[model samples]
Target: MKKTNYHTHTYRCGHANGNEEDMIQAAIDMGIEELGMCCHVPFPHYRKHLIRSLPSVRGVRSLLSLLKAIIKDGPNMRMPYRDMETHLELLSQYQKSYEDKIKIYKGFEAEGLSVYFDYYQKLLYEHKVDYLILGHHFHKHCISNDYFGKEKMTKKDIYLYCNDVEKALETNLFSYLAHPDLFLIGYNQFDLDVQTVSRRICQKAKDLNIPLEINAGGMRRGLKNINGEQLFLYPNAHFWDIASEVGNDVIIGFDAHDPSDFNDAMYNQMIKFAQDHRLHLIDHFDFLQGDFKKFQSEYDIR
Candidate 1:
């Protein structure tokens, strides 16, 4: 298989390290043929949404973080909207500069928040991004209380996450589902509810013709012993068992938060995981376009 990774992040996201060039050079050194820079998407008027979500803030830390984001408009979790133009412009320059070494594409790892659907559509339609991947990390808002990857997500939260993913996929905006089993990070145990939702997510992606990512980030976290079985937090054995059964297409994502994450060890691990699961792994995917007419009608845009 040709080495390619579509899920990569940059230092602009605050939580990650490495700049655009640092990441690109790493990919080229690792013999990656194509690389997509899909950092956590920045939002315009992010503080407005954070302020509106004040009532939903649950704990002191989360509340404080939200307040800080509202006040600073800095990279709380993502780059600020003010940095969006510069980020994309630099990426465009790198794409051209690195054309001979590796194919580069601009993209974002985005949340499936309804409030930002319009913004996502704008990003795609305006050619600002080549694609968006559904990395639904939060529900309703970007606060910690709504974070799906929190240490204690409820059954209701998982259901809401699944619903948001389905809604986003239906919009045809997201090219693939990133870490589709992210709920498993907090909600341990491969019980009936987990099975039900996993099947639903896999089936949805299968039907939509969007590939599900076997994210290496989860693998990098190391294995956890859950219910007598040691498994990666995501690309969870149980989840992929369902995905394999449902016959969904799979893609290996470095989900690189650092330049070193583009190494052969992680890549090989992902490949073997896909092979072990009997997943139909693909090296590339179609850059699905956003259906602006449908988006306009659904959002009641003129």
Candidate 2:
């Protein structure tokens, strides 16, 4: 039996647990055919690679020596980038070493640039990345300044995330939307017109052949954010239900930050729910691949 956890996270994002290799090993242990490492694409300008998400916590910063070295030597002869390349080559060698066992996709969880488009473009060009997973983890307003506290996301923040997602759709950059309902992660605001807006957003996503996600890590059946109380991410089951109404383009996402959660019962329940509701596999896009139907047959998806 084989499973694929497409929406995954790594330590590079600053909050997620586990390293790259740990996730790979977990996938192997769990019989996953494919594992996608979806990390945050840092905006060099605003976020400085680490997002200052919580209050009293400053984000990761660049070293002045690093800037000087890059400026002096240019891209080819840099110290750490060269070191990083060498290390990455070793990581790739491990993949080659185990090519028969697991297939991996290297990608990033890109923040849909609300105000950091220029910085976003810099990262895309710099990395020339394979594929992207859309995450409005922090809005530009949140990243740009000291708006951090609890994850007290607002429905307006939902609007911001979707709006940025709309931009990612325009760029044709994302393979699938990650935890598309995350804005309600810590909060649930029922007053907003999230369904209408999300429906319109889903329409555009479907038109572009982009996949919307059914996240399993948060509220069960879309009640409210699991942590705080400010906004609704997808608004109960309303948004997922709306996405289901769109037919074969919606996707199921476990949003598995922790590897042990790979075989959690919630994974199957969500798949069964998506199967019953009729959603797409987000990984079907070009950058990576998986077959949810076959997955169910092989892995007891029910």
Candidate 3:
């Protein structure tokens, strides 16, 4: 184990705290040798996308948040597009300054949005990012209403999540899948449908040689009693059991939102979780390139 974490967030993402240096220093202090700054991806025309997605918006909170994002051009769930240049530049500077202490990689944790497939591809092919991880939190749009982890996820929604993940994997754009079981967050029960999707996702990752992340964000939420069963929103026992049986490669992501999140206790807990499930844990993975040309030619994306 090299003590690496490829899933980390920065202050530019709005929801998280600390700058790139702060996060890197924290990781170094925790003896983390390799750290990837994978902030929530900033789109090129975020406001335009938000306005275009208005028809699909639902709920008071979701609508309000969408409006706020459109009005302020600030981070609602992701960093503002205008901030991307400065964010990456600063990370690049820190990468050099901290070269002796740690290995830093620039990346993004992105949703599987078809509209942004070109943008995501550009980020990689243009050398703007080293890698990307598929964190498919939304369906067609990034609004809370379309969020896969919302409390009201239906069987249809989970299936959609699985479908999006499978499609994203096929593109070979992402190095790994983040929180592959996030669909189980609000769905509560792990029934036959859940089992089917879980196996499908695990098998796909196994076949593609992409690692599945055991995200700590869900573990940080603590346990909940669902029908007399205590379970974390994700890294759900049922999901990982299927993954274990399928023999998918697993990686433990702190999913760090703050500097303090890079501690020993959480790391040990994640390790124990992997050990308990008999997961094939790996500390590193190959950063796969996004085959945009091939994808475009096959799907006629343009």
Top candidate (lDDT): 3
Candidate 3, residue 99: how far the Cα is off, in Å: 0.9
Per-residue alpha-carbon lDDT of model 1 for 151-268, expressed as tens digits?
8878888888888889889888899999999998889877788888899999999999999999998899899887778888887998998999999999999999899998999999
Q: Whole-model lDDT, candidate 1?
A: 0.90
Candidate 1 residue 279 C-alpha distance from true site, Å: 0.4
Instruction: Give lDDT per model, in order.
Output: 0.90, 0.55, 0.91
RMSD of each: 1.4, 10.7, 1.8
lDDT winner, 1 or 2: 1
Question: Which 10-residue span in candidate 2 carries the lowest summed lDDT?
Answer: 74-83
**TM-score: model 2 vs. ground truth:** 0.68
Cα error, candidate 3, residue 158 (Å): 0.8
Q: What are the TM-scores, per candidate, against the unseen true structure? A: 0.97, 0.68, 0.97
For candidate 2, the clash count comes to 6
Better of 1 and 2 by TM-score: 1
- Superposed on all Cα atoms, model 1 deviates from the true structure by an RMSD in Å of 1.4
Which stretches in model 3 have alpha-carbon errors above 4 Å?
295-302
lDDT of 2 by residue, 87-182 (tens): 345446656776899887666666665444433343344454456677655554333222211356565666666676677666655677766665
Ranking by lDDT: 3, 1, 2
Q: In model 1, what is the error at residue 250, expressed in angstroms? A: 0.4
Q: Candidate 3, overall lDDT?
A: 0.91
